[model samples]
Target: MTAQDHHSTDLQRNLTNRHLQLIAIGGAIGTGLFMGSGKTISLAGPSILIIYMIIGTMVFFLMRALGEMLLSNLNYKSFVDMAYDLLGPGVGFYVGWTYWLGWVFVGMADLTAVVSYLTFWLPAGASFSPIDQALISAGCVIFLLLLNLLTVKLFGEVEFWFAIIKIVAIIALIIAGAYMVATHYTSPGGSVASISNIWSHGGMFPNGVNGFLAGFQIAIFAFIGVELVGTTAAETKDPTKNLPKAVNSIPVRVILFYVLSLVVVMSVTPWTEVKADRSPFVELFLMAGIPTAAVIMNLVVLSSVMSSMNSGIFSTSRMMFGLSRDAQAPKMMSFLTKSGVPANGLLFSCACIMGGSLLQYFVPNTIEAFTLAGTLCTILFISVWIIILLCYIRYRKSRPELHTASSFKMPGGVFMSYVVIIFFVFTIGILSLEDDTRRSLVVSPIWLLVLAIGYFGFYKPRIKNQNTPTKKF
Candidate 1:
């Protein structure tokens, strides 16, 4: 390829080790952890800690499988590419568009979240109307679009600082909670802080087995974007070194960010006292007598949501660009700016994301819309992870030489893949146990039916007539 052709077709490798490292951390920590943990704690009490650990372990294994496949063939851009090569073009098209729609839902949730967070700074008894909220959501989408259109490295820098703010907030919470426990600090509610607070509330199983299972419904959504690091493979400076380093640190990130932070919160304010409707992080600071706790945590959580939205924009655009290149999407989506940014894909995704704001007008109840979007996103993400594992199983069997010669092979190989698949099946079963999530489960088939109509009715026939092989990355 000539210089111009190369610039037009290939993504720039501008992301360094630091960028990838923090992006990995940012992907693992979601707004769900900050905003939804209180509800999880309320449902399952101290058992929520064990819930996070279990989900985190399974996610780590999934990432390991993704990392191995990505390294095994550097030509592969993302898991989408792996599916295309190992599976068939039909499955590849489905995975690509399904993953794209999943991020679109996530972007919608984040957009709504940003609007809600902005309302936190309003004066008492003041509020934003639906129109006002929609405008604000549009403004955020435009700002992020402009930033992303600059260059790939700029996106990395944006995520780097955003992830830094999140890390600082969590670390601060953990430190303050530990001090409160050591000093036996007493809140105005007369609840004394102690290590025993976690268990003493209800002997660790206050809500029983049913409550413990219910925790998985929300906790699994907290880890939705954990595979985001794989999306950065094409733009990363050195996949061989950086990818493994990021994947290997999953256990520590889970422990420090999820497990440890929750433990600290419960230890400071007993699980029974954590409010279901509010953020435990903010409540923790409030219990510690920080007058500005609400404002500070509002800012932190706002940044966290934006970081996630930014990742959504970046991932969805890249996936669309890749699909377009393979003739599965519009040709215009494959167009890149001089800086190697996929401007067309970015604009398209931002347009869809703006629909979230419009929901404020139509749906009227933003929380319900957000929940529906989140549930659908969780279902689709789990499906994608399962597809990735199937790709890994195929890789091991068809290319034993690659697996044998590989440096970062998945532990336990195919056996482990089957185990994780069963775990996800159980997780999906858990989703049906709740009304809100079950509603989403029932609605998910409509999307699959749409994909089927597009594929068999339109895409398959078009490709068969062309009689040309799909382009390999």
Candidate 2:
């Protein structure tokens, strides 16, 4: 094994094998695969499956790279700690803060989904009233806040079930789709659809390259929490053993959950016929002439939101704890509760949710609200990944021994890391072109600027003597 003394110091490995398993599964499947796959299908046609598979391949390597780094040494508490050790404290500051913001933006978007799902009980246009929306959104936030404030085990347990529901929903959908294919049951609309429907309409990229490219825009976000499995390593009980299981199975699961699921959906219903603005999976049942598809999908999406929010709470708190331990955040955040959970940090994040939920209620439309928030989420997440690549480059140079001895080393060594970084930059450039995402493109750089200011404003001043070893957090 590689020497752990070079990295981890403060992280206590408290997460269990089960927690790691559920967390990784939840990360692979997002709300998008459940709800937004239709849009991907519309843009890319059945070729959306191709887009998902390609994104999965790239994301798998990124997670594998992260696992290798975290497992390189026991001294490494988390990725931010590794960044500090290998790339110096400046990169750590940026990575640590940028990572936290990624979840915040994500959390806000998930919260929006929760409110949207709640509208199922209300009259059609009821959500249009700001006062009504505010009260209900606040109530939803409070429900999640309570869930988060409980024991981490409880949170993990809930996520386990949430993930199970999502998994089951997909399995049922796939099974139903398979039966229809085998029996050659025609759609109620009197259309005889078959697996050939995937190709016959547009021959995969029927909508053209623009559709395929647009599919990437959505596919990338589906892969957002790909690295989150690493955060739980410190909390994860028996991480060395369990982490491998979760991390290694990622490729197979992504292919099954995304590629296979979409193939089935498109086969059951033509990609061209799937709803573009709403969920495709549910639409398949709806189009199959099932009356209860909307209700069933409502439950599925609700689980997706809860899972995302629950994860958001867990990950953001860990980031805060890491930052405070390293003096990037207030010290109180570093302290843990009796259950070994960072109680205060969790509450602070929940508080941020309340603040944002209030803003979302006042926003014009839920889609408008989510688009704005999702854009910022994408920016912060993109920045966080970029910093990871940057840190890995320095990691290879500064700690050659770890690089050489590492288990599950990132493929492509330092070169591919740079390549991924360039891809991320290009994504930013594309975001700059779209009216919806352009504003977030403008705002995201300010976070980097603020971190630069904070480093100079706070942490850098404390590192007065280069020769004197600083506190290794």
Candidate 3:
């Protein structure tokens, strides 16, 4: 066999179509959807549904472009691989590190959220100190780290069940909401829970153009993990077939999990009635007279947060592995266990999460820390998406033969690339309008500056040395 053929066996293709399907579903339905939907509904009223659909549409095209490029060269593992080849090493290094940090922070945020959720069951008074929560969060991370270090299939199995919980919860919520609306059940507040609640509260765009724009801030975060499916390219059993099927189902998942769920929520409880500080899912169950609403929603959300952390770990480990192969990170990170898991990278990522957990423990304001980390994550994710689009554009031009020969060509091709890029720009501009979100806009430039310094100061010199031949040799 050829040397390349032998090396291909290093990453075992153990992820079946089933794993890909649910990972896609779980990735699309994030903690943001559960935690932030209440605020989004209050912000945009019924127009939030439109906002979700718009973002979902743009992301669909973006995934297709990524999938097409991935399929074009089976050697490519993730978007970073595409950037390294189509763009330059500088683009690759920047995008890779940014994406890694994005997940690192995501893992951090979810780790904190998990601790907060766990504290609900803690006995009040002295037993519920921040130390206890930190320990609990650390334990949970350790459990996930151990499970992930087992095998790729194990990670897939865990995600599959986590996704099943989320799906069933959403489906059950929709059914219950539909039943309440059909019977014209009135909430405890005496407002008739009807489909009209969507528009009855000061019409569809209740807050006008500005309120509608406000929805984008939270709604965009809801879709943060949607591109996670793209990260599974290397482990997938059949990328050409399974990848396309997973990509095609994104819109369906978004509609069902996001749009439909929100519609049912607002219909059962008016948008204005939904509390910004609480989950709408819990609110709906409580309004329907379920005494265990908080407990039930807590369990579901805990699972959702765990799932997000799981995905973050998986993506970050894989990213570090790719970076090591490119000589952009410590070579030890590229080593794999007998089961094809990146053990060193996994441990390194878990260590970072542990540090963030300590930060969450010391910080008196958990919300502020969450906001800062989440905004940083969103900005970095957006940057990576823009890079993917740019790489796709470059792929089309530099390899017209491959573009034309490929079966899964992006529908609008390069034109759609520009369209999505512009949409991202519009979203960034919208961030500037909000006082709370504007900090993300201001801080984003500093992040770019750090990345520039890292790439030039560290990666550039080593890359030049590695590429150059020694005269003595």
Candidate 4:
């Protein structure tokens, strides 16, 4: 028996250590890292390795802060809900809806990418067209959403495998790269480019300090969904126990899956050969003389997208469900079907995702929509992180008595939260340095502004006692 057994929260604890672990892992690995890593390498050159490590470490601390606050009070289900309780209903409304929009945009971009990857298996002439692909991708989106709406276990199982597939693939790539590196062989030949591919190009900071700094703009996107684990605490069977294990392992996974993988990639192929708009995973496989590298990588990436879409549905519906129980959102979204599922909320998000099908179908450029969607992801992610920071700061002031009761405390306390907020602000400022990313920088704030308006316009203040007794999270 564990201490969590004797001390359970009000929200129904339905997830296990395994469920929380996979949820965290699934959030950590994304289609972007699989696809956009090549672009990252192109932008920062070899210094991308250092950039990932530093960012991963900082994010680890951020999650730590979140974990402490979440476990600080059992009343907290989703982070936004917690924000509302600790701060006010306004923060919850704004953060919750913004977070939902973030995932919606992320799903749209990922669904489109899935279809684009599916193109590798289709005829070249037919594959290049965006509209046809959107139709099929939309179908895939429906299939995954059904899985989410049907069963919580189904969503968990699917995400488990989705993460495992990405994990296994990254692991395999690392091994293959190690083999090439040991043999002193690679596609592009140069002493510095060979073994020294990581730093020899321009002494690690090839493009200078600013180029490495610029990597954070996109790097933040890869870490966008990492907070999904925090949202899942409501569903975890032993959130107090399992959540800690899952949260603690984030650092290890980030290092093994991201940092180590990038080292092998640049070591085996050299950053010089990596293209601006391509995936390093595909490039590495192709360089290894694997004939179907394109198709195989596509399948893996498609699977990653599907995993995220499924998760997006689950997370948004749960958030809506939490809000509804508190009377912040529409009652329909809160109503659960016989199986205890938020049927209306799930359908609502799916309906929004279906709108993406229209987006991909009618939008003149698939790439532009994808880029805009990516920018939206960065914005929503940063906003949620910021909200968590403010919530923690308030938690310390309002509930100093309960802080000692928490088993897993966010180290460094308010100071850490303040530091992370500044780090995020700096990241946001750097986003404008590039013209392509500048639009996203400008657009993301507008999205948050819209969320702020919705909170004040539509919802009433959350009553303090509204969530007194609730089992569903």
Candidate 5:
């Protein structure tokens, strides 16, 4: 079959309002919040709450700009397409591949998180060897791969339920925490739970400016998938209505899921005492005298990691499919299964994700591996977000008519786009304040260099030859 014939089958619009809404919520509530918040609390004290809000506010504005651009043209599948149409093919190629790699890193980090949570279920003296952890990570990847191969609707249904579980768990924790504070319940450590606990230890900024900056590194990772809904635009049933609804709800989800949940946890456990090596969610329930808290919270966090990983697989495959159609990737990646799923791209992404299991043998320490993956994903994601903003700026200048006609306009328009871009630049600067994140920053440019080499040396030349006129003999 010709390349055009191979990609003739288009992705279906099977995702509904409910699916899109929950997917957005699920994306916003990443595993980082559940697993990494403990360390953030420890580093920044109660001020981590403010950090989340600041990040969330900036992200909401970013999403608004993204939503406006996506709505301006229903033909655009994802921000990659928007980048292609507004910026150019070269920029689109870079964004598509970089976004794919970002999700791959996120998948690795999620797998590491799953193994860490599973260890909670083991006996005090028992632990998973490197082989055992690798096997578990492989099994999880295979299971998610099989599920995504079914249909787009199934992916949506799975995310809907996954998001519901996360929402319910956080709500229960918040309610239980409020009751504890009201009743002044005393923990095993003799620390009394009270509203004043948020600031009593050493005031809100107990760890000082450096500590506050340290919190941004992990806290930024927690918000990595917030833009995932933009990827569903092609498969969404009604782009104009559903896309805006999903984007509009981001602020609410951030406040409830990130800010409020952490406030309750710090109030109950005190930020100074929150363990950097463990999940504060599990610890909060354990301190509440819930006998099976570890088991239950472990299960909840395991599901959370799986949810994010599922998202990673779905997004990477879709991105690959898009890139292949644009002739920026291998043609085989664009092939669709009978169910309208990008089967080739899906399998390829899963294969890459399975490689993450090997980190257990090489790194040994799960937290260290997780941190490295998270830092890399954060840097890549920040780059993608910056590109999206740049696309919006280009769109405004080139096609002012579209901006004028946009029903869901970005709040500040071009000015906000520049502001958000500067904020991302500042966040990258914040990553340099720490040793762990700084390493990723140093290694990130190498990926871009490789992309530059691929584009100029290979894809660009091939496209040029294909476009040049041939002489008839």
Candidate 6:
């Protein structure tokens, strides 16, 4: 069999360099930057800029480690496959399911965001009730299911256009904000556009150590999908060339889309005046006296959530496919359609997402539901990242020959892996200090316990049968 056939049993390697580039871009930018930045800025003041830089740098290291292993073996599909080979079957199974759960909650959160944004256009009364929103959320889940079922290329195509809209919107906002600052124009809120706004209002770290740490809670979530490009290792064409380029460009995306954009936002308006609940993008345009500021911003924000939800579905289905191939999940999930799409896996993931909408329908308090769900997602995602770092460390020691032979090596090597791992542990410790997020830290252990049970109880028995014979009689 050819290398392509040996590597991908069902998934087609149809995603080109263009698709990989856009997927990387889409993964880096999320609704969190557009909407949640207002709150993060309020929490951390001008210091939020530094917060993004720190997190972005660490994530780039994690991606480098992942890319190294992925390129080490062309037959290896994702981190899931690498974990199976280097860290043993247990690590692979655990990471695979937790990763799926992480994205499932992310999709749930974005689904709620979709409904909330839709309320902007609808009348506030019976036209926008909980039932109405639930139905709309279900419709969105169905739409994503259909889109993903078509083909991997189509999934990449949708993400490409969605990412373009975000890229264009941010570039335009930055330009407008720069102009207002250059002219020293005043906003309707009476705040003047000046670079001094970053430090003038209570200095950079307005909220002190406590507030600076608080910003990490939400800002970290913004970077949740940055590792998504790693998941596309199987479908990507010319992964060696395309994957590294996609991974290396993350630092640029972070600087431009995140740091520069936020600098412009806070510079145009004082950090203290920014509303925690509203999007800074909309507020910035409104400050510049744009006629359709609300409509334009709403459309862009809608696209942001749609992009996130689409990615959530894609990643979750792929994870399920990996899990099933290893016999860690339902065997049916491994079945693929003629187009090389994992239709069963896609359908199962959407079913779970629809359940998120139902939770919103039954639960009267949306904010509480969102907080609990978001916290769980943060915990699970952190675990997945830690697993990737840990697997990289194991790969270095267990397969020294591979490391010595590789062209693209992780910059810091094993020492950097330890540093990143310690950093992640510290972040978890920080999460425990907050009342809102502490519960997730407490609840996450239960998930690990359950995965342990599933691994021993189900997947272990099938491992011997799954592996090939080493010697012929």
Among the numbered candidates, top lDDT falls to 5
The alpha-carbon lDDT assigned to residue 363 of candidate 2 equals 80
Off by over 4 Å in 5: 1-8, 468-473
Tens digit per residue, CA lDDT, model 4, 1-473: 74323432233455667777887888888866875677678778877877788778778888988888878775677788677777766777788887888888888877666665665566645544656766776787788767876666667777888888888887877776787788876453342224677877677888887788778767767777788988888778867787788889988988898889889878877787886555677767666566575467667777887877778888878877776766767766776654557777888888887777776777635545666677767877787888888888888898888677877888788898898889888887888877778888776667757766666555543333353442332
lDDT of 6 by residue, 38-77 (tens): 7788788999999999999999999999999999888888
Looking at model 4, the pairs that clash are 13-237, 14-236, 14-237, 15-236, 15-237
Model 1: per-residue Cα lDDT over 1-473, one tens digit each: 55447556778899999999999999888867876687788888999999999999999899999999999999999999999899988788889999999999888877766766676677866778888878888888889999999999999999999999999999988888899899999988888999999899788889999999989987888898889999999999989999999999999999999999999999989998897655788778777677586578878988998999999999999998998888788888988888999989999988998888787656545556666787889899999999999999999999899898899989888999999999998998898888978999999989889999988988888889989776665
Residues 168-231 of candidate 5: C-alpha lDDT, one tens digit per residue: 8888888988988899989988888888999999999998999998999999999999899989
Least well predicted 10-residue stretch by lDDT in candidate 3: 1-10
The digit string of per-residue lDDT tens for model 2 on 170-196 reads 888888888888887787887565889
Which segments of model 4 are wrong by more than 4 Å? 1-12, 122-127, 186-193, 292-294, 362-367, 461-473
The reply for model 3, stretches above 4 Å from the true place, is 1-9, 119-128, 362-367, 468-473
Cα lDDT of candidate 4 equals: 0.74
The lDDT for every candidate, in the order shown, is 0.87, 0.74, 0.84, 0.74, 0.89, 0.84
Once superposed on the true structure, which residue ranges of model 6 sit more than 4 Å away at CA?
A: 1-9, 122-127, 362-368, 462-473
Clashes of each: 0, 15, 0, 5, 0, 0
Q: Supply the TM-score for candidate 5.
A: 0.97
lDDT of 3 by residue, 279-354 (tens): 7887787666764865887799889989999999999898888888778899878888878888888999888877
TM-score of 4: 0.90
TM-score of each: 0.96, 0.91, 0.93, 0.90, 0.97, 0.94
Evaluate model 2: give its TM-score: 0.91
Report lDDT (Cα) of residue 443, candidate 5. Answer: 92
